[model samples]
Target: MCWKKRFWFLWNARLQPPMPDASKGVGHLWNHNALKGYHYFEIKTIRSSNMKRITTLAFFACLILSISCNIYKEKKPSQVHPQLSPLEKYVAAPDTAFRYELRSTLPGKGYTTYVLYLQSQRWLSEKEVKNPLWWHWLTIVVPDEVKGGTGLLYIGEGSRKTELPTAAHPIILQSALATHTITAAVHNVPNQPVEFTDDDFGPRVEDELIAHGWRQYLDGGGTEADSKWLARLPMTKAAVRAMDAVQQFCKEKTQKEVSRFTVIGASKRGWATWTTAIADDRVVAIAPVVIDLLNVVPSFQHHWQAYGFWAPAVSDYVREGIMDRQNTAAYQRLIETVEPYTFRKRLDLPKFLINAASDQFFLPDSWQFYWNGLVGEKHLRYVPNAGHSLSGSDAIESFVAFYHAIVNNEPRPDFDWKTADGNILINTDPQFQPDSIWLWQTANRNARDFRKETIGTTWTRSPVEFSADGKYKLDIEKPAKGYAAFFVELVFVGDGPVPFKFTTGVVVRPEEMPFGDYNTTK
Candidate 1:
């Protein structure tokens, strides 16, 4: 296409006209938001209706939109949260499988500070070690109604009410079982010099470590204020605590012997979950949601338009120079010292990445390889149509189910992610007919306007090949190139009339795949 056509497309997209059939009779499109689980009214054609009736209906429509908007808002501690449930509601009677002893003393008067030593790299000094990036932490483990000391360690990336509150999770504190409690702690990292004013990233509390890279600014001494992205400090805290310190804290809490613990988080805390698992071998399992940054820097560099990170100011790619090979001494030191994607290749742990489709903060296409990068027992519970939280009444229940399964050492059916010969093989657990892997691509490699990116702007569907035994594969057409987000999204087809819905995906960069010709494909 010529520059004329490109400009025309953008112009048309930005100022799209009403439908061609708007002159016809009134038409109402009943759009069901599967993620939020609601029926939203889309007025395809109003058809100049009755004055009084139209006014009344319009009022109701505005009311519905107002209520739905709250679904995406983050819950703050100051807000009225649900009260905690009774003691027995935490868990069922004692089960022998998830058993452990409880015996640990609480340090400090109100909150205890733990020292985190940097192990993967040597950037920390004696002072940094003694006063290592520390967060005020407190455990709410009531060992009266439970047997085992199994717990959920939530790195508080969003809440502030729990500094002394008995409940662990800011939102799901009431749902936590007596059988299990939570270790709630805030991540104490510096702030960024520049603050994002965007709706999602700006709230400040939601993404503590979202804008994480500090190499460019700190190395060049450009400007350093304070942010969770205080470079090596975050990795040190996440790694040390997830690996050994948290478990030790639990073991000490429960005088009896405690088994491994489960680490759960969302967004920036989700990134910390992966880093902690990678650093510490003691984590039984990890359930991270809506983060999808493990293999991001490399993939984001090649596909910047569709893959702009949630926190670009502090992103490892942005700070280290996105397109640069980054082999410079300073770049190499920064990569090895603070980046999470730097260590994505060797990740081995049971991960239940419960991510949603159409997350506003991230391009689903850029997240293709997030699940595949893990070399451990991993499962993808793709929540449909949800945003960053991927939430609902059963959201915490879903998380607890996965964590408990990991705790009891339940059988986790294996899922394969491999590129053999020219075929990308993906084997999932039974229960599937088969459809296609709805792949997404971006039009521009610049700042993606997600609000305006529609089906034509940022989505593409690719047909998939399926076998009799429930395994599926997608054969690449020659070696495609250029950078686009290709997600191995298994479109499950049922018996009746194929009602298709895209769930979570195994997002991967084409260059990263075996026969992935993404760089050359147009």
Candidate 2:
């Protein structure tokens, strides 16, 4: 026993010079120790030392090996982990086939716009899709008075397959100058007019692409190979790569590294904004405009209940039979892969959901289905007298305000609301009292539908005042003959450039489901 103990001391002194602190990880140390331990075990002196010493030495060697292996594993990056979400896996996948070229630069009133042509990536092989190469015209608005390292990314949609870049969007430029932050807008979000097969695919740009990919995946029996071909993969990849492009381009051109971002978009682009935030950590905040159906399954079902028939706006989804197969296991898998609500736990940053009071694609009261399930700081605004397009409305002002607050690290007004008895109750932070409050209400005597096209811009506003208890309450009176929808809008006019507007979830009187449940006409 004394001789064996002496041997252990000599062996330790000779082999282990001094193990590095485990925090830096065991990289080469593991290999060196493993090989040395193996050779040491084969020595004849160890064999003659006796069974007790041999067993002790083997146990000690095993203990050291386990620690070294764990140290190496601890240092591995989370991106390489097997538990990555489908969106994360797709976006993080290495794609060296990417390039960007600065097409032109134009000077604005107080900002400079750079038009860059970006080839994001090749989605699938040419055998699968006609044009796998995804390209876009990106307009980056660098304000003369840039504030911080953070920039605003607007994921916009367009179908123009042109040789020359078109004009920059007025709203994007306005936001850049208003917020005084570096702003960028990426067009052709999915690289439109792509031919999937000999078939026309459809008239729409983004939805048709999504439906086609879903059809292929569903028809192929939901294999792993089929999942990889989802249209959302390239859509999300495009936004992620746009950030990469801007960061690199800004560094090289302006000599200012825009490291952080706040992403905004409307319709399908809004959906991409949510997924992009989940896929990339550089997104400091998000303002998803008018894509309100987050918990997709329940929200759509609620849509069916409100309007006995599916709105014509969603005909693209109906044409591809995507709406009909919403109840299947394959559809659930699809939702898990691409739906933002599936990854709700990951959306902890500030989110400002800018919606329309009468969106053609979604119901005004759709927030009830998914709002409570969301975690972290969130704000909602349903712009009155507007629809899916939000044209001729001031919704952009609210969005710009939200982005400005996030980029400047300014505290936005905090508020919450709920339905009680026959009225909607709103309680705001005492320190952050709003400048004004109004109740936007409308009634539909013929049906439960409140689509902008069906009801027009009939929503009227009435001044609302705080009660004795310091909570603003709006009386939700059920129409004697038909259904009515109402919400309280709080306009917070602070020192920011634009007034931040937010609203309580819209409440519809006579809460009744006219359509019973989701019934597909397919």
Candidate 3:
């Protein structure tokens, strides 16, 4: 007999002794027979005189139970490996397309945590049938520092065709000529997903690219609940997993190794962009616009306020579970674990820092503080008269300039605040005290005829003035002559005659003045 058949035969024969116990019909008989059968089976398997005697004795004992048994037991065939279902096969296939969904876990009462889905697409064409572009993944770090960190939020995407205005088309077209793709991401305090959205933010950015003739794919739907769950998750593991998923997606879709890509994040999302860059080497460039990096204090407060509605439940959960055991040391441990991976140095690709002079949440000074730390091929653009929402004309122009510089290897031009040539003069009087305040006069002298009219005829009063102490003043008149601008300096020499220095005319244009760092000399 085959080994399989023999194995089943022995199993059935052994089971026959116990089969008499149908509805407790053979309690003692089954037990007694089963014991005898075990002994007989073991002895028969051994070949010896002693074994034969033992087997004959055991067999006789079990044989006595056969007299009372009449009914036979039914047997069923066993299965090993089961057949694959249709859904299983489809999911397992490498060529199928799938949309990404976020999964989140909440570990605290006041915080949200999330696992963002990283999806990539295959490039399908007649010439390159199976060519695919790898998918790159990233995660937003809320208050990006604290352990059991909560109050993270993400916004959902809006309709591309419906939301973006016609005026934004020109800007988008310009950006497309300079960038491989147009993308955007979000960031919020831990456990708060207030403003994250793909339609309102992502599609608008993509629409700008689509207007410029590039195919676009944008997907993001981060909410407050998502943030709470993300907060409770371990930052280091999530970051590693996100990076892996992105790399795998990219490799699968492109069929080629993906070594470099860009990451773009605005507002709070800019924090995520920075964190992702620090975490992964594959990220080639990072554009973080209007980021706040002065301190974590303000962010922590903002997150609490932004996500107050969910705090009660999240807090309760944390108190009941793992959070109650945590202290400052525990939080520090988490930060230390993720800091090395999330704090990136200079990159091989372009890094753009864009901000507005009057940003509400993130001050101009904050951008200066953060960008100063960034190394490598870096560029910064500050828009005047622009607010927190940087959709203004000046801001858009600055963004376009940055994109062009990065893609085309063009250098950014220096800022200038001049139109025409004119000279400014400051009037100084000797009869002023050391601490006395005095009003000064400005002279804008436009030299009309330098050949004949020398002193009085060519002299014009340019709107510029100075104080006795040489501390503060204003330019009342704009220049309109030569390529020169001027200012007056006052040096107070006690309460007597004060020495004055008439600054040489310096030519300046509106674009030449540096923003944010006002105290360059200091």
Candidate 4:
């Protein structure tokens, strides 16, 4: 219903003339000639006529008064007319939320993709759908073989196809979970269209509803472009709305409740993923890759971080410039409203943080305080010899394995690592022995001299031996380049050859800087 409303008004009122002289008992004159003087001359002509013409003018005046009163009543913004959001339609069941344009199945995959316009909450909230805009939501069903009650929702500016004609494509549905992965993606709201004249009203309001941002704006108030009350941010609102639709669709279409759910994203979307995890209890897990911005304090520092990459996100607030970037209250307010780390103590869900030691965006050490503060079953995987590529690596499989364990009521594997003395200790299962354990240098991940034929090289091993307690100790000197990453290389797990279940190579760096890799950036 919000997709069909039109907001347009005709201009036909005249402007009042300027004041003449208040001392002469004449200030201003009310003129209703539509500012073209046509009605004014017509009235003059009628006044010169006889009594019969005046009586006719009186009748017309009464009719015009009645119409004006009716129009005024209709124009008042306070009159309440409520409407349901897109997710609400699935619950209420009259197809009020969405209109499907094309629905087809992916070839050989048995997954369905739907191209449709999702009605926005702006139209739903303001009544009559006065501001209506359309965008596509690419919905992909999990493969037929793995039909289960778990749902993963991805919201990002992903790729698109001609059939769906959108920027959102399924990033995770094709992974290990695809056998039963149901996914929905909502694109960044379209650039405000050209024809929608109400720049900040209607469905367009949803995009601009978040006026820059401030701590008070989290729950939604402030003097914004509208009435001066801080505007509500649609960032988290839009995410929740789209996810609600995805879960609801999975529930109704599959005739099974999506008992387990996870929200996944990278970068800024990672921020949304964590925010979504905290806001919604149904989300059993959250995987936010490479973006670690939590209770951002003034003293926080990232030494290995390249300069000029640190731009404060809170600066987007309308009044942020009023105070300096170093202002403590400003930083605290930002943490209170937008930072998910502010409430890290209350979280009880499992979270998988896929990061890399050499990440260009966020330094691994920069995440210590925030990551440790999480009150959840947290997993921080900082891959050695890798930068941001961890997002596409074995991390994907780990996520699926984790969700599978969760939905099937099983246990997820642990990659426990601790460093002491001169060796890395790995608590093993006795039966599983790593093929080799190598200490790597971050600056040297690019070139490591080794022979191709041999799987085990003495150069790669640094006098490492296994002890009776299952801890592997390495007797090696630190690299000269100033950074070290280590991994326990296990024999490749393949069909029938390995006795491990859901096992992959485990990597970890020290809580503090490792040997030969202390911060020397000046």
Candidate 5:
């Protein structure tokens, strides 16, 4: 028999079906393997009908066993830490996952000290999800050796609070898993209690920082006088402890050997930011806003006025004397030492100086003076309409934008600035200036145009009609709550036969009272 015929005969025999004669079988039944079940089954009978029955039973048995095995197998649960809650573990991890908070303290001068509060948050990852425990190791250095081995300060979750009207708040760190690390000597200062309130600007900024996933290490617990005295110190042991604390925090938390860090401050704290950056080369960037070096001189003057007994007096103080010259010299020396502007030129680090054009405390000239002395590529942004407090939405937005750009290596967006000379001109016709009318409005209709030195002069009216023959310069004062409309006929300044028609719209600021309440007719 041919090989094909033999194979078919074997397959049919194994299948044990009622086999047809070779003359009757054709196509697939004759040419191909008709009884593949032979691979898994054994023949129990020589009769084709019995063989077919046994093969059918064997196939069903195999199928049932496969299904039973699958049903019997068990799956393993995920291996996450049993000790920690999901939220806590998630916060502790470094992945771009969950947000967390960390707390530390720095030494302060005199019988005063401060607490450093830090908060951070982000999204989670799959690997971190699989193993959800988080470990943060921090190494803190002090001016002197602390008596207890436990220098770490843990702020619990309930400690996070904010005075802002918004809903977001700070996250407080409850505990940190500790590890042994290098010990550095710390200097001790007499501990004095300082109370910082939410009404203060520092706390407000802290709240803002927390909302944006930033951690703040506020050196607290000092009275205003103690803080000023600390500022006077030349590289105080307390300051060194603060820097060391930050360095250790970075090294331990990130598990990276960070040698340098950036420090930023606004308003009065700008002094501290400048001082810290100058005293330590480990500082990578120093940004101070709304600060004027010259203001230090005036600050002393104010200090004397407030507390004359405590103030140091020097005759001809402006020209010479330790009280005046020492501070001036100190200011110059600090600028020279930090070389804040030129630090990048020599050390490849960045320095930024920010101020507001309308800052009440520091003059714009003071900023210009500082900017002029800078040797390296210095960046200066003069925010318009921002005050010394820098509390407005515009100022906060600018600060946030600048901060993320520096810390996260993100791109900064371009901003357009409007100058004082840019007039809010109204042009009735696109082509001709003669066809337009301009009106300047103020908060009060009775208010004078200070720009023109005119008192109680109003320019709030809409021009109703213009005569071709008359020289019209009409001023209409509109109601505080309504829109004012004007119609005017314009001609060339000298005199012209041609006239163009114009209309303008002006909206007054909303009044406090409801219209019905203000109306006598009601």
Candidate 6:
């Protein structure tokens, strides 16, 4: 390539946030072929011989460096642990099968959107081709202000839509504009409501397909490899391949590379965000919303204990008979292959774990089973009045704020919190001050369940002040009748467009098991 083309390539490729060792400068750029044979000494020689040409080159290089420094202030790459390989295999295995076609482009307010029909992969084997091939409508929204090698990838859920989107999702458009980075949303995560003829399963999506996979492994005498072909494999691969598609599209459109991503997903897609972070090294941060049931075995046990029955949200697993076969070796193998908790050690990326306090799918206290086991910087929020749908809440605003932080390399709030001796203790870093702090609590006098459907909108919040000892604490008084769940939430309004919210894990008072331990049935 000519030097001008090379410069464009280098400008587009290296002109984003600097990685940690980025200050190594021209020599490092040369090592990466950003300037194949050029070095600092050559620049010096050019400066002595040709002032104007050297000045132009010098100005260009400095612009790139300054932008890099300004965007991510020595942001470090995520540490990828070497233990997990099954997810990696599933992602890379279907790469050769990857393809996409730009179906349409829609001009939007302050942004341009590209809609492509993407065939992310052909999952499963030929014998299992009775199911549909993995296909999706991948939408890439690039704001007029977009500038960077980092972008956001949102894993979304829906049945296949053959027609192209008339416009991008409003939140995605807003995110691209707010974050000033390309944002992509890929739908049909599991390509769902799918029917597998060989397995005799019909019209399954989300947890149904997952439950089917678990049953196939535990009860159908399937091997660990068979478990690898479960719904999560393809679901996760869709996001990975979506990243590949976005990078390739950006390269073609602007000669730029999207080298890093902050992934966001909700519910089943949120679960994929965890697996995708483990599977792909490019993920710098993750916001997993409403899919709090990590550490599956213990989480489920906690779920059963909380309600004295499997909540209707998890009936798919129960109907699959998976609850009865947790002891089997096949089930263990399946867990190791797909459970986010099993690969928690590999998830060193920054994480924003958001869930609903009244989620019908999971208990408010489910974080206790897996939060500490996570390996890196983490934040949490249990949206007080929200449930599995998170409707009528400002949850999306939090997601946008967290994404802005990741893209800008903003420091997360510093704090340590724990439930101890029936009280929640929080010690905030002196540098981090909250705009407001409140204690959110609710009571379930009749049963242990806290679902909004059963309990209505009974959660209430009260202002809390730091104690004289300088620690923020909330004492728990066991309810005289049944159960009370509560947590302390701190809200910080950062320089970003929205406030950042974090919380202590919800603690249920009167620590008593209302039901027997790990029963097979309600």
Which candidate wins on lDDT? 2
Candidate 4 vs 6: which has more lDDT: 6
* CA lDDT for candidate 4: 0.42
TM values, all candidates:
0.50, 0.83, 0.33, 0.57, 0.32, 0.82
Model 4 regions more than 4 Å off: 1-107, 123-136, 158-170, 176-179, 189-233, 251-256, 298-300, 303-326, 384-395, 418-438, 444-468, 472-522
Per-residue lDDT of 173-228 in model 6, one digit per residue for the tens? 77898888999888778776666666666677778888887777666565645755
lDDT tens digits, residues 282-391, model 1?
Answer: 45677777675555455444344344332442344343343343434544444454456666555666677766544655655454545555565666654433556564
Q: What's the count of clashing pairs in each model shown?
A: 38, 0, 73, 9, 22, 0
lDDT of 2 by residue, 133-163 (tens): 7777778988888878888888877654444
lDDT of prediction 5: 0.30
All-Cα superposition RMSD per candidate: 25.0, 14.3, 28.6, 19.3, 31.7, 11.3
The local lDDT score (0 to 100) that residue 192 gets in candidate 3 is: 17
Q: Which stretches of candidate 2 lie over 4 Å from their true place?
A: 1-81, 198-204, 519-522
Candidate 1: worst-modelled 10 consecutive residues by lDDT: 30-39
Q: Residue 74 error for model 3, in Å?
A: 41
**Arranged by TM-score, best first:** 2, 6, 4, 1, 3, 5
lDDT of 4 by residue, 1-522 (tens): 121110011111122133222224211111111000001112333545586878787768655654653454354232212242222221222112232222334434455554333332232232323333223343544555555666676645321122333322535554324335565555543212212333343332222333333332332322222221222223344455555455444444655445456777665567767766655555677777656546555213432132222323323332323223324443445445446776677566877776554554444445544654677576655554344445334555555555555545554444445546545556755554444444443323222211111112121323245556656544344555433334344332322212112212222232243222223111
Give the RMSD in angstroms, all C-alphas superposed, for model 1: 25.0
Q: What is each predicted model's overall lDDT from 0 to 1?
A: 0.41, 0.76, 0.31, 0.42, 0.30, 0.74
* lDDT ranking of the models: 2, 6, 4, 1, 3, 5
Question: What TM-score does model 4 achieve against the real structure?
Answer: 0.57
* TM-score computed on alpha carbons, candidate 5: 0.32
Instruction: Quickly count the clashes in candidate 1.
Output: 38
